[model samples]
Each structure stands twice: as structure tokens, then as C-alpha cells.
Target chain A: MHEGSITSQIVENVLREAEKRKAKRVLEVHLEIGKLMFLNPEQVHFWYQMLTKNTILEGSQLLIEEKPGTVKCPKCGYEGDFQYVDDPALHMPMPTLNCPKCDGTVKIVSGKDCFIKTVKMLI
Target chain B: MKINDVVKAEEGEIFDIELDENILKANAELAQQNRELLRKQGVKAIDVMGSIGAGKTSLIEKMVQKLKTHYRIAVFKGDLTTTIDAEIIGKHGVNVVAINTGKECHLDANLVQKALRRLDLEATDLLFIENVGNLICPAEFPLGSEKRIVVISVTEGPYMVVKHPFIFMDADVAVINKIDLAEAMGVDIAKLQNDVKKINPKTKTVTTNCRTGKGVDQVIAALNL
Candidate 1:
């Protein structure tokens, strides 16, 4: 529901970029949504269209590219996408999801972010 | 940035700052604004972070009661969904506000700035921010808090210190909750202490059983409140 909270911010930045470049007639707005941010691209799109009206980005297209949630495993020399599933080898009582290599806990390398990475417009 | 005796443990990898440059600037500006407001108001900020169900809320509740009588307190509690933490803590009557993070793993400075609009930092002597309950995300950002406190329970792992050293490294003090279960789970307190020292020798860590109000007094004393 705070989609507006973030969307409004994106629109402002999109306008700032367009203005900095001294461009007119905005075109496509580029966004990079990180997996760790827990934001849905579809929800962003839904709000983007609704929020951009009557502004510099009015009728401008919003293009979003998702960055995966990657983590580095301490035990295994593997760094890639993370999957959370319960597993047993991790510890005592219950099975908890862990690193695929050495059953170690992995830390997210990136992907939890919501930002207007790049914005394209006509001069 | 100056190096502080922390090891990378490996070579650097190529990644990128995926967020918008403008948004990053905006966020930085917001953090500065909150920093000014906090200073102007004399509000002391404490950030609470831990894994899901690690007892962050219980410790906060106890702290609110402990500090409220001597001074006015404001709380900013973060959760992915539902204001249940805020609602529960509100019953204690300490002017607690909830931040529903929607899907974000951590709370950045900009969000804290927005929340500050709703909070009167001047009327309050102390402020506590309960970060989202996951250990992985909250370590990424600082919410302009004067003190950052990381809450960990005994059930998580003895290796928790090694698992999330960043969270603890920034913490002024550490609160280890669920102490009553330490014995039942065969927890090694000494090992946990060693792991914590390895991560951060400066962090003052304390174990607490929030359900029974044990060790909370020590928590207050550590903060000098």
C-alpha cells in the first residue's frame, strides 16, 4: 500500500534525470527492482501508470529489470541465487534451509532494492 | 572509508549499486535532515534488529516501560506486514509507531525521515526503532539512530555472531533473548561469547529472558538510561 510512497519518489527522480539532460517528451523509465527489497515488479507497474499522470513522466513507459538475490556461502565456494527451504544438516532441533555446498548460512550479495536505475527520454 | 581491522575474508567481487543515483542522493539528504532534527530535539535513537521471532518486540516492550517513567519515549517498529507489533506495544502507552515495510528487508534512512514527521522527537527523551525481523537485510542500512542494538535469541544459533557480524558490529549493545531455553537447547554460552568477540570486540552483549523480565535492568544500565 506504500507503493505510492516509493512510486512518488521514483517519479521525482525520473523528472530530475530528464531535467538534468534537458530532455523533452519522456519515453521509457528504467527501474531495477532488487529481490531483497521484497517488492513486486507488477505492483510497481500498477502504481507507476497511476502515479505518473500529469507529470513529466505522464504517459511515459516504465520498464523494470529485476536483480536476483545472490548470497555467498561461507562453507562452500559457491555464490549464486538463494533458495529458502527447510533442511536438517544446519543444526540441532529442526531442518532449516542452508547453503547447498557446505550447509552454511549464506548472506545476500545484493537484490533487495527499489530504485529508478535509469530513465530514458527524448531531447 | 577508513579500515577498522575488519577482514574481507576473500577477494572483492564485482557487483553494482542498483538503486537510482538520484534516489541514493535523496536518501542521503533525508538522513541528514533526520540527523539535524534528532540533534535539535535531543532525541536518542536505538535501532533493534534480529531474526524472525528472536524476541526483539519483548525486549523493546520492557525497555519502553523502563524508560517511560523517567522520560518520554518514542518507538518506530518495523515489520514486513501487519502493525501487530505496534498494536501490542501501544497497549503499554509509550507513543509507539509501526512501519509496515511492505516487502523491503531493511529500513533505510529515507523511511526513517518520513516516520519522523509523525513522531515528536522533542517531547521524547529516547527513541527505539525495531527493524524488520530478518537478520539478513537489516544490516545494510542505518536509520539515523544514535545507538543500534541487535537482538538475538538463544534458539537461533551459536554461530549467529559469525552469521551476521555486521549487525552486531554496528550495535552499541547486544541483547540475547530467550535465556530460559538456553539450557534446554544445550547452548554453549562461552562459544557464543567467543564468536561475538571475533566479530566485534567493542560490542557489549547481554543475555536476557524478556518473558520474565530478567537482565532488562542490565540493558538499561548499559545504555546509561
Candidate 2:
């Protein structure tokens, strides 16, 4: 899964920053994940714990902030929240690409980021 | 304090570092480097992605057979464990490299960078990178290809396009393969294409029965190959 790899990258970045600052230990990691990313926060936490074993980030609290999905329709000039396609077969509702107003193709505006916002550590 | 001591301090001078780093940026940078490298060598590379059994290899085979006479082509096929697809493409008298991703569900730019080292880029005019047969993970990773083609067959049912909209949104060309089985499978190609268009009108949709080489030329034309 891409989330596994991405979480590993987050660990690498956090550790790099920690090392640069000469921190004795990491206290917390703050991540702002967008809705469209479809990344499971639990899976990320699991991977983070697995990758940070015996490291400065060990036992650090991970604060995940989920952002909502948003889109901008080009045809009808509609901007804001979009709709999700509900299906009985799917375990979760999928975000629809069609504009909620005009049902035309919409461009993703926000809520696609999986970013590491801040890292709290002891200097 | 001991250097290796486990200090779970409830109160301390907590320093906050605002990194504001995107997790996918590293791979995106590497992909840009790959794009520059391919451009310098005058090579056209296309990344092929789709669900398993979407006939990615077959489409590549047909394209290779038709264009081999005019261009020096190469293929980099990504799979979890086997080189079966690589072997299939190698029989077409073109240089083919198989990339084993181990447990990865998609091919990232870093892996493609390693594969590029094994290929003779200067001698190659066209490169086709067959990503792991996956619809979801591959959409998040870019392998520095000039174009991305996502193939979906009629056998996957009519909802495959809308069910996974992100991949189609990112794709430059959408190949609705297995048209020969459309009638028998009771799948509507028109609706599938419409779904693709509604997601991203910029994406060019082509229907093909890659097994019989039907509509393969249109795919080539769509990619400007």
C-alpha cells in the first residue's frame, strides 16, 4: 500500500528534522491528512510505530488532523464541497468527481494533501 | 539525563518545528528528475496502469509490434514477484526489463530511476513502463513518464470507471480494452467512456480489443506515437 511507504517517508522526515535540531527525544508528530487521500490514519500510526522502533520518535504521540475534500467545477463554475457516490458493494462512500451543482467534470481544489505539519521535540 | 534514557516528560520546554512537508513531494521531485533525464535522451516514455487482468501487457505487445520497425523500443514491466509480463514483451525483439517491487502495490519514481540505469536510454526512442496491475496505488505515484494510460476491460463491469475516479482523473489516455467481450459481458462501452469524460474531459478515451489488435492503432494515435 502507498500509505505504508508514505508513512515511512514521514518517519524519515521527522527523524531528519529531529537530528538537525539535536533533540533529545521527539514528543509528538502533527499530520494534516486530506480526505481525498483515502489514507487510513490507523494504518499510518501502525507503520509509524513499526518504523520508529528504538528511535528518538519512539512512543511519540501522533496527532492526525483530517481535512475535508473539496472540488471546483469548470463547466458550471461551481466551487465547494462535492458529493460521494454511495454503493452497496463498496465498504465506504467514494468521492464523486462530478460537480455537485451541474454534474460536470470538476477539478480537485483541496483536501488531497498528506502533510507533516509540525514536530514537537525536546531540545 | 542519560542519552538513551526513556524520558516521558509531562512538562518540558517543547519546541515545535513547522516542517509543512508533503509526504509525496520526495517522489514527485524524483519523478521530475526522471522526466528531465528522458527528455535529454529524446525518449518518449509512457506509464501504463490498470487493474489486474486489464491487458496492459497485451496492449504493450501490440504497440511494440506495430512500432518496432520505426523506433528502438524498450519496456520496463513492474510486478510484485514474477517476470512473466517481462518475458512476454521480450519475445517481441525489444529490450525489456522486469522490475520486482517485492510487496509494493505500485511502481514509484525511485524504482523507475533504478530501472533506468539498466536501460540504454540513448539507444532507445520509446519506452513503455508497465506499472504493477493496480488501479489505486499507481495513481499516487508518478514514474516520470511523458504520458499515463489506464486500461479497463469490459469484463470488470460498468462501474470500474466511476468506482475508481482518481486513476481516470490522472490518466492522459483511458483504454477501454476487451471490446470484443462487451456484448457478451453486457457492459456498455459508451457509458464507460462517458464516465471517463465526466471525470476528466481532457482525458482521451479509446476502446480496444487488445487481444485481436483492434483499435490498437487509435491508442497509438491518441498517444501521438
lDDT to native, each model:
0.73, 0.89
Residue pairs with colliding backbones in model 2 are none
lDDT of 1 by residue, B11-110 (tens): 3332222335534455556767777789889988888888889898999898888778897888888888898889889988989778888888778887
TM-score list, all predictions:
0.61, 0.85
Question: DockQ of each candidate's interface versus the true one?
Answer: 0.09, 0.56
Q: Per-residue lDDT of A1-123 in model 1, one digit per residue for the tens?
A: 245567778887667766776666576777877754535678888888888878767887788887766767666767887644233543422211246576465555666456677655666
Q: Which stretches of candidate 2 lie over 4 Å from their true place?
A: A49-59, A68-111, B1-12
lDDT of 2 at A107: 82
Off by over 4 Å in 1: A1-123, B1-25
Scoring the B chain of model 1 against the true B chain gives a TM-score of 0.86
